[model samples]
Target chain A: MRSINAADITEAVANLFKQANYNLGADVLAALKKARKTEESPAGRDALDAILENTRIPAKENIPLCQDCGTAVVFLEVGQAVLIVKGDVSKAVNDGVQQAYKEGYLRKSMVIHPFSTRTNTGDNTPAVIHTTIVPGNKVKITVLPKGGGAENMAKLGMLLPVAGRQGVIDFVVKAVEQAWSNPCPPVIVGVGIGGTAEKAMEMAKHALIRKVGQPSPDKENAALEKDILHKVNNLGIGPMGYGGRITAFAVHVETFPAHITALPVAVNLQCHSARHRETVI
Target chain B: MIKGIILPLTEKDIKSLKTGDNVLLSGTLYVARDAAHRKMIDALDRGEPLPFDIKGQTIYYMGPSPAPPGKVIGAAGPTTSVRMDAYTPKLLAKGLKGMIGKGVRSPEVKDAVKKYKAVYFAAVGGAGALISKTIIKSKVVAYPDLGPEAVLRLEVKDFPATVINDIFGGDLYIEGKKKYSLAQ
Candidate 1:
């Protein structure tokens, strides 16, 4: 078995959090530039300009892209052939996040209790970690700094298998319509199809890390993305939902086989920042 | 046209505003988000004084990151406003004259804007870096245990925003959508 030091994971995750906070993804920046050119509303155009300029701040001066440094979400793709050494992988990851948020001046958004005391965890620890075992010996880590505002608007539904293409299309469109500016448009829509309820929700969120403008690998799924994109943008939710022609910058769909009777659907809304970064070790 | 506005907006100032008005706001401002709003309401219930007076004042929904040394505040921008909808009407009734944030408001909150002759402004969401440049100074006014969610009294100059809701019930989101909507 290939042994990997958990310290490497910790250090990598720490740096990822620091970078992802202020560094707007290049793909997201490109999409916004294109949107700014084609956006119909004058107000929407101005909003787009402000957004584009905000992305430049980190390069000139070190400041987060937005104040809500978001909940640290880490996805681990671990190879079955590997063994973690020196420490636990999960603890390493949390330790990395804690150091990064504290030192990098990122906001510590995690609360100790959901309902009661609601105390700050201070270090933004206990990252929402999703782990999967794959074939290779390498560990791939992806950090998505997911803002609470957009996350709160994510929706999941378990349809009776009868709620086919049209059902999904209607549901996603309505979710975007209802979420409106709250997710901070022009938003990116991530659709998870054909998985169990929780898996679908996870897939939907995972879809956001995909590069903008790239369609799903499946021909049929790509078409679904296009259809959803068209409908969502046509909702006139525009940039920052101030109303324009570009409510959604892109729609990505990830699909997996589900039980015969289940047509689980989940829509994950990502705000304009769409901050995420990945590294394989 | 981009209009310059001074803070502590009164009913007269709000009545003069309309939805979609581009404003460059200057003067004193307070920042609070979900946790701070909840705490403020709890303080109200306990009959304790608010950190700052509510009359003719404006609140911005945000919890900024820690400043990166030598700055008055860190990247600061509007958070989703509707999260504070529950506490907004109560605050408005007590003379909270204006609010600055992003996102759609609940119907009740919008109604409160009209009833109280208050105005709701939308700062550019995701433009925290640019927005923070406008903040001249900031300090924790209350609930320090809340950390970033604590109530912060901020002094700002020429902060850019758009009037999204006005005293006359003008709603920019609805109107903008209706105007550009393909189906319409």
Candidate 2:
């Protein structure tokens, strides 16, 4: 068995968090440039310009792209044949996040006893970690720092099985419309269809980790993604809700098989700052 | 070119502003977010004076990261304003004149703006790093233990924002959407 040190995982997690916070993904940056070219509303274009400039300032200043560094969401794909030596995986991951947030000057946004005390957790841990075992020996770690503004706008619909395609589209469009400027348009819409309710929500968030504007490889999901994107933009929430033609940078739909009785749909929106990074070891 | 407005906005300043007007603000603003707002309201509930005079002052609903060396402030941007909806009217009642934040406000906030003759401006969300450049100075004024959520006294110059709600009952979010929404 290939044994990997847990300390290395911790280091990778720390680096990923810092990198994700300090830099905007290249795909997201490219998409914003393209949106600026086509955005008809002057306000929308101006908003895009500010957003594009925001992308640059972080890299130069070594500051986070936004004040809300977000909750550290770590996705781990561990190879079944590999062994993690020297320490516990969860603690290692959390240590990395703690180190990065403290040393990198990233905001520690996580809170504990959320309902009662609403207390700040100080170091932005423990990270929301999801782990899966894969066939290969390499471990893949992806950090998606989810900001609260967009995350609070997530919605789920338990549609009737007969609701089908149009129903799914309508639900998503309405969710985005209701969200309006809150999620920080032009946003990236992540749609999860089928599966159980929680699974659908998880899939919706996972869909956001995809490259900006990249369509699903599945033919039907790809078409559905396009349709949802068109309808959401039609809502005219526009860039930062200034009202324009380009509301969403992209719509990503991820699906899983579900029980015959249920047609679950979940929508998770990502702000234009869309920050995520991945590393394989 | 965008119009530049000085802070400690007077009645004349509030009256002149309209929804969708893009303007650059140069002046001092007190920065506060969720925790600070709560503390302010609690202090008022106890009949104690606020940390600072609220008269004609603009508050920025912002959260900031720790400043790196050679920087006065780190990436500072507007947080979601609606989260502070519960405490806004109280502060408005106490003479708060303006607010800078992102996202839509509740109807109560709109009514409070009209009643109080205050204005609401939206700085581009997620543009924190760019926004930080305008923050020439920052100092924590109260609730220091709240970390980044602490209330800060800030001096800003040429801070870019768009009027989202104005004293004349004009709402840019509503008006802008109506103008561009295809279904309508």
Candidate 3:
């Protein structure tokens, strides 16, 4: 068995938080550049320019890309052959997040409660961590700082098996139309098809980490993504929802087999900031 | 090319602004979002005086990152505006004239803008670092317990924003989309 020190994981996660907040990822940057070119409205084009310029300023000056530094969402793929030594895995992740938010000067956006009290957790700890045991020895960690504006707009629905592909497209298009400029336009639409309700939602979020405009390996899913993309852009949401031809930069669909009776789908919308960073240790 | 106006401005100065007009703001503004708005509205309900006067002042719906040493603020950009929509009309009733944030507002907010002769401005969402450059100073003014959601009194200069909803009910998002939308 390959033994990985828990301290190493903690250090890696901490560094990931700091780096991700300071640097805008290449995939997201490329998508923004493409959106700038395709956006039709003058106001939409101007918004895109500001977003690009913001990324540059943050990287050059070592500041965060957005004031809502977002909740630290850690996705971990731990290989079955590896054993974590020295400490508790979950606590280690939280420790790293705490250190990063404090040291990196990012905002602490997490609250202790949702409806009541609404107390702040000062250090931005207790990250939303998801871990999966996979085949390899290396552990892959991806940090996605999900802002509230986009997170609040996420949707999930369970359709009867008979609803088919058109149902999926309709649900996604409707969700984007309803959200309009609320999630901040020129958004990325992540669609999760099949699976159970919760799994579908997770899949939709996971799909967002894929490179922009990259299609699913499955031919059917790729076609679905393309159709949904066309429908969403046609909604006239445009950049910042100010109206334009480029409402969505890309629509990424990920799918899995489900029970014969279920056709669950989930849509997780991400604003243009789309802050995500990954590391393999 | 549209001319940009200097900041530390008044309602009278911004009233002439229209949707899609580019404006460069210079001078001081405050930063407040959901938590701060709730508290401020509560105080108003209690008939207690606000920590900062609402007259001729611009409040940005932002909760900025802690500043690095030698910097005024970190990634100080606008947050989504709709979250504070419920509290905005009340604030506007008190002579709150200008607001800076992202996203669209409710019809009530648009109506309030026209009723109160206030202006709703849109800053580039996600352009925190670029926006922070314009803020010359920042300090917590109220609701410090809310952490990053605290109300901050900021001094800004030459900040860039667009008039999204003007006093005449001109909605930039609606109008802009209508102009560019293709019939499906």
Q: Which ranking of candidates, highest TM-score first?
A: 2, 1, 3
- Residue A101 Cα positional deviation in candidate 2, in Å, after optimal superposition: 0.6
Off by over 4 Å in 1: none
**Model 1 Cα displacement at B119 (Å)?**
0.4
Residue B98 alpha-carbon offset, candidate 1, angstroms = 0.7
Q: Which has the better DockQ: candidate 1, or candidate 3?
A: 1
CAPRI quality level assigned to candidate 3 from its DockQ score: medium
CA lDDT, every model vs. true structure: 0.91, 0.93, 0.86
Please give, for residues B96-131, the per-residue lDDT of candidate 2 as tens digits: 999999999999999999998999999999999999
Candidate 3's displacement at residue A32, Å, is: 1.6
For residue B30, what is the lDDT in candidate 1?
90
DockQ of each: 0.77, 0.78, 0.76
lDDT of 2 at B102: 93
Candidate 1 similarity to native, TM-score: 0.98
lDDT of 2 at B75: 92
Residue B82, model 3, lDDT: 92
Candidate 2 Cα outliers beyond 4 Å, as residue runs: none
lDDT ranking, best first: 2, 1, 3
- Where does candidate 1 chain A have its weakest 10-residue lDDT segment? A54-63
- Candidate 3 — which residues are off by over 4 angstroms? B6-11
For this target, which candidate reaches the highest lDDT against the unseen true structure?
2
